[model samples]
Target chain A: MKRFLVVGSRDLTEYVNGKYVPLVVEELRAKGHDVTLFLIENGVIAARDGSKAGKVLNGLSDKGARVYAEDVSCRARGVQTLASGISFSNLDFLADSIAEGFDNIVWY
Target chain B: MGKTEPPGSKKKKTQKVAIILSTGSYQREAPTTVLRLAEKLLERDIEVNVFAFEEAVTLTNRDQIEHNEPPSLRKVLGDRHVYVGKFVDQLLRVGLHGAKMDWVTCVLCAQERGVENHQIGGSIVGTLGDLWKFVRGADHVIAIPTYR
Candidate 1:
């Protein structure tokens, strides 16, 4: 089981709507791989309450994949409250994850 | 003490690097970045393989275009190391015909799209399975997907 860190720098409208990165996350998880979704930039909006893409993210979170939103990105956009099951993260944490040797790092 | 070995006794292993470029030429930094990375890798004696998918097919057939001081992608990727997706390349061809790399358009993709013309030189018909094999066999694989 390879470890994967998926970085999302785009918003949900451009990302989940196109069904590329989200589908990749779902498919990788289905294949029994360890996957983490790291949302940055406008991607933080995807994990907020009552968002169209947040619903999909929530489902993915329940399906055994961890979801995180970057702290600064959320704050810059005035997003203080994240949806249930979503957590805050930063690039340092991402760097540490890479230093710990994740098999693959995919940025979308 | 270490034993002295003869020159050329150990064969150097070539690292296979595969890159998937899905963006079109001049769309953004990705198109040029892929070529730059490939050039750097090639300079280090690494084996570079590029798979151009989606709108990136325009890059394979596009003539010399200079934008914002970027090097010519066609000259950088060279002739034999690049591969263009057949379906998109054929659909978007402007008859410029300067591609020097290999073209592997899947038969199924062509048939599904009702594409019958395969007139471009340095082109071939292949399958998704072949591309998968190329990627899986590489030591490193980097995919620069479309921004849209």
Candidate 2:
């Protein structure tokens, strides 16, 4: 399995319901790769608790996929109540993932 | 360092790409990567589907655009039939879809952008079901978000 840093977006309504954020994360883990999902902008909401995605988000953690959220994005978007594995980080984390050899495949 | 295949050794690889943007005209690095990736897949004859949602719907709007480098907007959208209504038909025309997905949040986005009644053609904008369908079979999905 290839190293993937899947990207999520900010729109959680209409086209972007919460279920998919974890669906992608779960698939990556099922494939047996070291995976981590980065929530940027709207993606940050996936990290929140008590949502349908929180179950999947925590499942990703169980399967060893680290969930990361952008701190700046969180603050900018005014997101609170993050999920278990979801935590804040920097946008440079994305760059670092790339430098560490994660081919990015984002979902917004 | 691993057993990675050389440049164009891929023929039947599966890919799922979701692109979210504020507007189709925001020619940033994300779109650049996405457009280039779509082009590469088409060139390699690998299966590629770019789920365009939010402002990404603008990706198919080939009118009055300006990001034409190796990623020619006219060519990229034209090649994948990103022009909207014909996206799937065009993919089939090029013999490139085992499964192609459309993730357009056209209504929500349209309203946000005051386009709730925008009659732009070349695309179909509808429901979350479509987004889930795309996510279901996606090998990999990416989002380029639009602030709207």
Candidate 3:
């Protein structure tokens, strides 16, 4: 399976074209490709417990796509608790992941 | 000052990363995010290529200066502020020693913004060809477009 890394830097409420990132992630998962959703900056808002974005991310996680919220971003925004299936990550993970190689790396 | 490999010896290929920054600084967090990622990537010994276009061409403007904040806003604005160009300059300088970083400012964009000749040292005025070249040669590519 082709590997994909999608980085989301904006909050869900700031969609310019109807939440393109989630749709792209969903499509990739539907196609059976491995996908990792990395949330950074304000994008960590999606990992907050009980938030609307968290629900959407939960759905994607149920489909086997991995989700990670940047630790620094989460702390900066005071996102103390994260929704299920979302793990705290750091830039180190991001750098290592890039070095590991991916078929596609998209930023939103 | 560099070591050369033997005529027939195989040399390890260095990893290369290309970051396309299309947004300007201060207004959004995209520029800061891209810079942080570039630094982290370089620390891993990866060669970084930054292709700046649109308003991003102003990021390396050498005219950036930190001025004293007005008295009314001193509490919030602080006495001094850090400009993004300083970080870009620092990265370029440090990259000279280890994993090299090449920062290219789009010529057309810089000209339109009147920053073509105001860019910091080592900022290359390049065309779309450089952007495509970086993308084609990179082992990984990260594109941060305008967030607005």
Candidate 1 root-mean-square deviation in Å: 13.0
**Candidate 2 off by > 4 Å:** A12-18, A50-52, B1-148
**Per-residue alpha-carbon lDDT of model 3 for B1-148, expressed as tens digits?**
1121111222343399899999886678888888888898889899999999899999999998987888989899899878899998889987868998999999999999999999999999999999999999998788886865
Give TM per candidate. Answer: 0.45, 0.44, 0.90
The better candidate by TM-score, 1 or 2, is 1
Per-residue C-alpha lDDT of model 2 across residues A19-59, encoded as one tens digit per residue: 67667777878888656677766666656677766667777
Write one digit per residue (lDDT tens) for candidate 1, span B1-148.
1121111212334366566766764575455545544544444445555665666555544332333323465476543433333333442242234222234545554444444253244445466776797689765566766785
Q: Candidate 1: lDDT over CA atoms? A: 0.61
Best by TM-score: 3
Local distance difference test values of all predictions, in order: 0.61, 0.53, 0.85
Question: What is model 3's DockQ versus the real complex?
Answer: 0.24
Q: Which docking band does candidate 1 fall into?
A: incorrect
Q: What is the TM-score of chain B alone in each candidate?
A: 0.53, 0.52, 0.84
Q: For residue B21, what is the lDDT in candidate 1?
A: 66
> Given candidate 3, what's the lDDT at residue B24?
86
All candidates: CA RMSD (Å): 13.0, 12.2, 7.1
Docking class for model 2 is incorrect
